[model samples]
Target: MEDRKLTVRSVERALDILLCFTRNDDLGLTEIAVQIGLHKSTVHRLLSTLEERGFVIRDAATEKYRLGMKIWELSTHLSRSDDPAILLLPAMERVRDHLGETVSLYLREGKERLRIQAVQSNQAIRRVAQVGARLPLYVGASSKVLVAFASTEEQEALLNDPEWPSWIDRVSYMEQLYEIRECGYAMSFEEREPGAAAISVPIANCHGVVTAALSVSGPVNRLSIDTLYEYAPYLMEAAHDMGLMIQ
Candidate 1:
């Protein structure tokens, strides 16, 4: 027998479910059900209702579900509402267009990394990441850029966890942070994923606190270390401009 039962389905639960969608760009029925800890049938029914209400939709081509146009339209109204992505997108677009690669905006959530926005190039071989994707702290160039700026206490805290990712050690991450600060940008070659390379520049608030980062990524073949060095100045320029714009 179930020891406890939910007496009512409140609006808060629905909203919490909606918020989960913001952590991931797309999810299938089973994935959503598992994440929300609900029965598959219940999740399916809720998703159908959400789809009818225009909060979500299923992509026939990929058979995956994602937030719908309505969400995007509604989100646009709040785009500038205390979120850096609003001010970052325009500058990000300029860099993306100039570099012909994928651009992303990232923010730190506690010790994790969150994607605030992403724009994939129209080019055939463009790299892409879901807008709401969350990744471990040591996953990629942008994530490491943010992590490198984290406080020593925070770094120590993460280091104490035995489950931390394999590639990042606290001492090494700290060293890399100093180098990134000295150079004004971060670059990595296939560190996070095979064949993916990226360059990142930190975004700061008016107080000069690092709040977010802007990055451009592409296949390693196309964005070699030498070329990434060549592109570093542009990324720094864009991040600086966007930070001022956000302020």
Candidate 2:
């Protein structure tokens, strides 16, 4: 009976740990402990166990814990769930069909940008994408859009990163972000990867939170800098449609 009671209490505490995370992507040990009214040692032990099982991940730089892809992987298929990745796939396919270029969806994952889904172009020379590919937040057009629309806190965090190029003026980049915010899209040619060009548009939640991005990509010659601008309207339209349905 004592063992049974201990098991019940453990389950309750575990549930409380999971419930401690909602809306926000990350929490530190102190924050979780204070929120759950538990000791720091207990919270650390629980988080350690959860990390071992892939229920959560710790950012090496921030030392904060966020729900892992394992949790996202499980919850994505729940009935009637309106996950943006699921919604973005079909829209991406349409963009590929419209432009005969590759289309992809991205979301900010920590300081890295994650490509969660993509539809490839039919051409032999087109850019190829893997679903789980990650890139730096400040580099590509899709990632730039995500950063531009991010909260001021997040933007500041990324801009202050030590990896920022020395030649690129921070003040100018800040101003450019404002332009991206005003125009509702971002474009790039040979910025991240040589011989590649991309055009991207933002996806905002019902709360006007800019959370994800949709982009079309192709070879630089076929989809030159000028062509990227021409494709912006189509990307914006698809992103706008998806934004309307994001709960």
Candidate 3:
């Protein structure tokens, strides 16, 4: 019984070490030890074991640790199995076909939003969304929609984060978030990539919790702000359908 308890405790500590990477992309041995309240020796042992399993990786030059490909592999598996991204592909495809642009589904991952699913446009000149892409949560329309509909505590945390670009107008951005909450959607022009434009709507689950952002994106020439507005109703309809699939 004592051996079993010790094994469980070790497992719990290892999980704590993995969770620490969610906040920061990388950490040194001592930083991880300090964060998890473990001695450096204990942390080192656990990290070595994790590294051996490809659950974590160490940077030889920086001597820092970050999550490894195995985590992504496991997540990919999870995303494939009854996940919202998989379930919402048809809706995304319909929106893409209707708008003649790329349609994508984004989910928040800590300080970033991840493109989990996408259907590309047939246009020769169009924006392309890569699945498994991560973008900051402060720029694009999908990012804004995800952050705008998040919990109040999360909003405050993001608003106060020091890593935001100096060019951002905080006051106006806050107001935009408020408008997004009121208007039910968001739009961005060249915020992340020049000549790129997108409009996004929040996708809420059956319990009214916003879980994802449904977006249509294309070249600025074809998807101006006005054009994006015209496409909003279709995006909203698809988002509503996706929401129903969540529960």
For TM-score, the strongest prediction is: 1
Q: Write the per-residue lDDT of candidate 1 for residues 1-247, one digit (tens) a residue.
A: 2333342463445565677776777888788777778888877777787889888889988877888888878967884656777666777788888999999999888767888899888789878878878887766888778877778787777767777866666677778878887888888888777889999988887777888988899998899999999999878877777777665
All candidates: CA RMSD (Å): 4.3, 8.8, 5.2
In terms of lDDT, which candidate is strongest? 3
RMSD of 1: 4.3
lDDT by residue for model 2 (1-247), tens: 9999988987788778887775356889898989989999988888898899898999989999988887888876685557777766777777888899998889898788888788999998999987777788878888889888888998887788787667778888888789999998888889989999988999887777777888888898998777877888877878888887777
| Rank order (by lDDT, best first) | 3, 2, 1
lDDT by residue for model 3 (1-247), tens: 9999999999999999998975588999999999999999999999999999999999999999999999989876675545887898887887877789999999999889988889999999988888878899989999999989999899888878888677888889889999999989999999899999999999999778999999889899998878988888877877887898896
lDDT of 2 at 164: 62
Worst 10-residue lDDT window, candidate 3: 76-85
Candidate 3 colliding pairs: none
How does model 1 score by TM-score?
0.76
lDDT of each: 0.80, 0.84, 0.90
Pairs in clash, predicted candidate 2? none
Residue 129 lDDT, candidate 3, scale 0-100: 86
Q: TM-score each candidate.
A: 0.76, 0.68, 0.72
TM-score of 2: 0.68
